[model samples]
Target: MNVKAQYRVGGSGLRENWFIGAGFGAQFFYGDHNRQMYFWDRVVPAYELHAGKWFTSGLGLRLALNGLQNHGVTQNGSHGTGEIYDASKWLEKQEFGYMNVHGDVMFDLMNMIEGYDYQRWHVIPYVGLGMMFTWEVPRSNEISANLGIFNTCYINESFDFTIDVRGSMVNDRFDGEQGGRSDEGMLTLAFGLIYKINYTDWNRPRWEAPPRRGPRRADAAKRLTSELRLSEYDALKKYKDDREVVRQEVAVLVPLPSATVQL
Candidate 1:
């Protein structure tokens, strides 16, 4: 069985902001062999609420509230006398459950993938591993609250009227077990899309170092020429005093401009 399964389908809300949503989906029994339910099975009708960083990147956790119904067949009275032979008669034990309070920690697995951002409209398939508990109440009791048994056949089988407030009548227990607290600790998983609110700018490129403030090739060449000329002038001036004859020849041949004189 695939450990990864999606349950909650199609989610949408404001991005990078607080969001509240209502979603309905099936809890597949494909996750683990123990969690699967079959036909005529009473599966809970599940819902969830989520709140997280508006549109953040990677691994986010959300709290989920779920409701489940257990409508599976149970052997009545154990294997012995008074043993219920017909499965149809077992309807007396069928119960309706309510889970007004249950919570789970949901893991956003899409965050595990590299560079998976939650800003765009992405169907981020998710799996939830958590616990759920439900209070089982007799279906007959709910019915009797409205319509009491009319026929003599059902008169003896009539639902206890006291259950109208307490829901304590009728033997609607699992596997035909004794009527008492039927609490279960279970693990649940589901796959669904988290439709991130669409945005024009989802990814912003990394900031690049401002293009190096560099001199162009022509500018560099001109700079090199000026430096060489200045160096030659300084060298000539330094040795000219020692060789007065050469100095006079240079002065006679070339008249220095004011710019050169200033240098």
Candidate 2:
């Protein structure tokens, strides 16, 4: 009987290869500004929570809830760098609370180009579109276009260390100011961990087996050394017996006569 082995592929389905993450970083707004400020003065803290699923090794999608704090510089009196008519226009930097809910399409560059494997690193770039809602006092909203890149290092089967650099373009009115360009831009840098849920490996190439062989069967007649027939050998043995027949001699005359006298 021949027994063949099969590959079990039940767990490798649409329900597999999901992931979630959390991250915090700094955000810088390139918005309308006047006068002078230090580099750190225009930056704010940013936070993010995200979940994603990989449809294949090369492609995936993610939804992220990003924001909490955002910084914006507005004119309290006038415009132009260091040319503000009012002295307090430089101090009009508004620290606001906001949230950006966005969905991104991610492409794993190495995995897509080199094929799937347990790689120690992956570089993923993405693009998204979202709405930014600002809160506290007068609540407002703006449509945003997003772009980002992620670098991930392998930690184990279920987790990875990740660093993300994100860039976004929003309506200039979102920051309560109008800039030279029609859209305003923001840049953020974050670090975090990603946990994959029910991750599954992709199918691999199969190997071909060599042909099988067994021991050869043996024949009794083929092992014989001499070429003699059984019937001839038996006839020769009988002839030798017939030719060698001989008579036996006995001495009994003296013994018989003594026994008769004794009786």
For each candidate, give its TM-score against the true structure. 0.36, 0.67
Q: Tens-digit lDDT track for model 2 on 101-220?
A: 889999887765544555579999999999888776456788889999987898998998999999988886776666576777678999999999988765533222222232211222
Q: Who wins the TM-score comparison?
A: 2
Q: Tens digits of per-residue lDDT for model 1 on 176-243?
A: 34433332222223232232223222243211122223554456457667777887888888787669
Runs of candidate 1 with Cα error greater than 4 angstroms are 1-17, 27-44, 54-56, 76-93, 100-111, 119-131, 136-263
lDDT of 2 at 254: 33
Q: Which candidate is the best by lDDT?
A: 2
RMSD of 1: 21.9
TM-score of 1: 0.36
Q: Locate the minimum summed-lDDT window of 10 residues in model 2.
A: 216-225
